[model samples]
Target: MKANPISPTIPLDAEGVHHGHLRLPYSRDDSAWGSVMIPICIVRNGSGPTALLTGGNHGDEYEGPLALFDLARSLDARALSGTVIVVPAMNYPAFRVGTRTSPIDKNNMNRSFPGKSDGTVTQKIADYFHRELLPRADIVLDFHSGGKTLDFLPFCAGHLLPDKAQEAKVFAAVRAFGAPWSMQMTEIDAVGMYDTAAEEMGKVFVTTELGGGGTSRAETVRIARRGVDNLLKHAGILRGAPEILPTRWLEMPDGCFCFAEEDGMIETTVDLGEKVEAGSVVARIWPIGRTGSEPHEIKANISGILVARHFPGLVQSGDCASVVATMAD
Candidate 1:
């Protein structure tokens, strides 16, 4: 493989506060020698574990980016024991346009992990993270929210990995994040996911769905800000102990998701964080083509709490409407 075209302006190993960009050259219609400059901040001190904290994996999600950018501006290198790499917006183009995927290649950033060196713009960014950034970190915390298409109860999460010890460490970080809920998350698909990439390297990883609707709230952002500090403390990268909070543990099992069966106006009976029983109607899709037509009812396959749901009013066939998750005992 050829060397990656992306170059960083700041040294990744320097001890002190440094800020710069990951410059990737892109020759487009506007300019023959144009480049995308993604903002990054590095804060380092003495010897300790590195915590690579990132946000804006998807463009529309704001909680992660909001908190991370604040931390980058306010964090003092003298108060740290190790390095903290902050990339508030991982998909800069997508974040600039406030979309889920990159505008340049229409590829989702999270799904472009372990990417090719010579590929699309999104892929190139992923390739750099896979090669340059992730290797230097002992722990990684990526933030996420519902974005425009979905909504979620504020929660920090980790997957059920095959490595028990690694999973334990990941879960410990998840709990230390101190969100309202701690989830054992299972993605519908995990191919090329950033979480997978970090975990495969045996790095302790945690992610979050703080809140959503293509926007963020004061409470959620507060959770995000505090969570990052908690994680650094948990990793021993910071001096203070994590601020402990009560968090309900939850898990999403297979068949717990409800999907729309037809296109129409969506009517959701259950709200987020609400309880529902198996076979209960979680949502309904009324036919837009005509009146007096029976709406397609989306029912819960298992009894659990409604952790997430589609955010918009309209629904299309095969779109996920609701996700019911059980209490993780």
Candidate 2:
């Protein structure tokens, strides 16, 4: 593999707090000699565990970036014992315009992991993380929320990994983060996810799906803020006990979602956190083109709580209507 063109403006290995950018050369029609400068903050003390905290995996999500940007500005190096690397906006291009994928290459950053070094803008960013940043971290927290297409109940989540020991650690971290709900997630596609990359590298990885709708609420932002602090505490990177809170455990299995069969205006029958039985109608899609036609019903495939739902009023064919996650005993 060729060396990534992305270069960090701050020293990765140091004994104090540093704020800089991950500069990547980019040439476009507007500026022939322009670059993408991704902001980064590294706070390190004496040798200890390093926690890599990232946000804006998808440009539309806001909770992670809001919390992380605050952390970058307010975190004191004197109050830390390890390294805390914060990248508030991983996809700077998309984040700037509030899109889910990078505007430069129309590439979804979350799905472009372990990317080609000499590829497009998004691929180069992923390659930089894969080859350079991920190798130095002992624990990784990549923040996510339902973007413009969907909305979710605030929750901290971890995938059902093959490694039980690693899974245990990851779940423990999720518990320590203390969101309202703790989830054992099932990804529909994990081929090149950043989650898969970090977990494969044996790093304790935990992610989140706070409230969505392409925006952030103060409540969701607080959850993100407290969760990151608690994670640092749990990793022994910061000097404090994790503030564990009571959380309902949820399990999302594959195919636990209901999809819209036809495009129309979606009428949600169930709200987030509401429970529904299998085969129950979760949403109805009414045709806007013709008023007299019967609406298409979208039903739940599992008996569980509605954890996610599409955000927009109108729905296209094949859009997810709702996602149900079973209660964990």
Report the poorest 10 consecutive residues by lDDT, candidate 2: 252-261
TM-score (all chains, Cα) for each model: 0.99, 0.99
What are the per-residue Cα lDDT tens digits for candidate 1 across 182-274? 999999889999999999999998999988889999999999999999999999998899999999999998887788878899988998899
lDDT by residue for model 2 (1-329), tens: 68899999999998888999999999999989999999999999999999999999999999999999999999988888889999999999999999999988899998999998999999999999999899999999999999999999899999888899999999999999999999999988898999999999999999999988999999999999999999999999999899978999999876687888899899999999998998899999999996699998887887989999999999999888899998887
RMSD of each: 0.7, 0.8
State how far residue 180 of model 2 sits from its true place (Å). Answer: 0.3
